[model samples]
Target chain A: MSQEKSLLNKLVFSLQCLPGVGRKSAQRMAYHLLDKDREGALRLANDLKSAMDEIGNCERCRDYTEASLCEICRNEKRNEQTLCVVESPADVAAIESTGSYTGKYFVLMGNLSPLDGIGPDEIGLNQLKTLVEQTDCQEIIVATSATVEGEATAHFISTIVQGVKDKQVSVSRLAQGVPIGGELEYLDSSTLALSLANRQSI
Target chain B: MSQEKSLLNKLVFSLQCLPGVGRKSAQRMAYHLLDKDREGALRLANDLKSAMDEIGNCERCRDYTEASLCEICRNEKRNEQTLCVVESPADVAAIESTGSYTGKYFVLMGNLSPLDGIGPDEIGLNQLKTLVEQTDCQEIIVATSATVEGEATAHFISTIVQGVKDKQVSVSRLAQGVPIGGELEYLDSSTLALSLANRQSI
Candidate 1:
């Protein structure tokens, strides 16, 4: 009984540590590991460890990558003149899955939220402005979220772009209601594609 | 962006390995890991490896354990004169969580399924008979599952117990209406307990 408890405890302790996973779910996972896919579970463990050890953020756009530049950033065909700014790689994947937009991107990585104390500096707003000024980008689209923080970050970027380059970069927001609060990944591919295509000037 | 992808991939991959988890849930978990519990994620990775490396079956009952004798077998207070036989530790736990029944257990580890090529030998039914014959146990309870295989295993145990032991070893079964398709691990504590208390003679 003590040995059984110890085995179960070890599994439960580890499983509960997963993000948002409570005790019950953790137990289910542990049982699943024992009953179903032992090898798959091992792979998952290895995948987790290796991914954490090896993967990093893109220096230019703040998108996820296994190398110095994300695949999109490294792509030569993507337009260098027009840049799309998004909050996360999932957003980038949302845009890319469309196969419609050929424009380049500058990822802000996050939005500005004064309440959360996540300011422009925190989300790399300064880097965004610098990239806009340094590049010959004619249009800079603010693809940040539609949330309050997203709105603030977009406006902040617009203002900073104007101040730095003294040039009017075509700043745009995603068409209204296209995005909910949390994620761009959950959006249907077609909707995300449409949102990118019908993007209007802000 | 590369670095972010590396870390996020681990989180996403790890989460997707959980039962009923999809890409959508994986992304949510990834965000939670980065935003709310980075340290927790690391702990999960480490603990998963450790549990897989350290935990195994109890030598006696074949229930998951970290030692030779399971807790039920080791505890001195538990009745040595009575033995309850079960399919798995999950079953043992279902019984134990109720805080009912003072008898010790003998876990078979699995049911008899001819399709899966799991026979009496596979579940160590002979070993159970040997243990019962050798021990001072006055009563042997067949608390295996209620499925077809479980019934078959129970009959086998009863037949073996009858042939080996000169004294009549009482054979009982946990009651039915436990949601036929349901697993022991998922039953509510009280319901599981009711099933145990109302168990009938086989």
Candidate 2:
């Protein structure tokens, strides 16, 4: 009756449901999947289903994991005394690929955003503090983004962890690994810049 | 041991899995999806799933249908004596969008690609012959692609469908709405050559 077009037009209409996708790209992706990669196109469907079914945050560090602990947390080779904290599971994955940081990671899952009503509890800050106290961690490197929320989160964690015991836990942020206000996740998709950019004594 | 970049990287990789989508376009698509519309991305994923689920070939005409008969085959007003054969459901959708055609349709599902181990049976040519023999189809339109496989298929189908005795089936083709060596699915998505070119009478 009213002609925006057919179901195909309506079908291609919702290309923006995927993260980091848009109108033209959505159309391109829809056409691409429907037109050529029938099997791979089906894979996208499977991915969404699997992600909905299996993807969950690590209960301990709040990173995406299929099990209770992510592969990083399960690894016994990592130094339990030195723990690196970051904003997202993606960030943890980025750090792990460098092979330089043998220390374990604690993912924040989200930064402090009071306006969005995202607080310490929502992002598992309590779990992080518990992990720090339970483990033999002497130093906690806060590698949250340099944004206001990231800075605020790191500052909050440092003050709390510092006040916990007479053990005098060391609290430090990443030493210029990120440009001001730039998310660490957006850095180039290569091992080179990620490792080279990571500095000592953060 | 590889860096996990932005959601954009996942987007590009996801889009690259689509048919005929190149890396640059995939990147462009990712930026577009991330920048403007996220719902479109999910819609594409959902669309692929729905189309895969609901759209199937008609039992009689081999046209796309959510039921045994497509809208055209179910329509009492449609010309039952004329059948237009195409290589895919996209072709049927394309023609139906014009609102000009009032005939039935038969979809091959694919062209005959023997090298890839695809044959007439795989693409449902035998069923098409059966449809032609049973129905009082006076005119048959062969609208297969002009590609090597498409031509071979059209030739094969024309031979089988026209060879049936008793009924006078005038087998013609649609040279008007299509271009030479062109794929129907890409007709709308791809760049055009000012392509207001009208069909010359065959």
Best-matching candidate per DockQ: 1
Per-residue alpha-carbon lDDT of candidate 2 for residues B1-202, written as tens digits (9 for 90 to 100):
3222323345456566864567766656544543344445556567777766665556776654557766667778889888888887667767877888888888877888898898889888888777878887888898887677777887888888878888778888655444678886778632343344542455
Worst 10 residues of 2 chain A by lDDT: A1-10
Chain A alone, TM-score per model = 0.80, 0.80
Best by lDDT: 1
Native-to-model Cα distance after best TM-score fit, residue B2 in candidate 1, in Å:
10
lDDT of each: 0.75, 0.69
lDDT of 1 at B87: 85
Candidate 2 share of real interface contacts: 0.27
Reference-based lDDT, residue A93, model 2: 56
After superposing candidate 1 on the true structure, give the runs of residues whose Cα lies further than 4 Å from its correct spot: A1-4, A177-202, B1-15, B34-36, B176-202
- Please write out the lDDT profile of model 2 over residues A101-149, one tens digit for every residue: 8988887767899998988897777887788778888999999987888
TM-score of 2: 0.63
**CA displacement after TM-score superposition, residue A49 of candidate 1 (Å):** 1.6
- Counting clashing residue pairs in each candidate, in order, gives 19, 21
Error of 2 at A196 (Å): 15
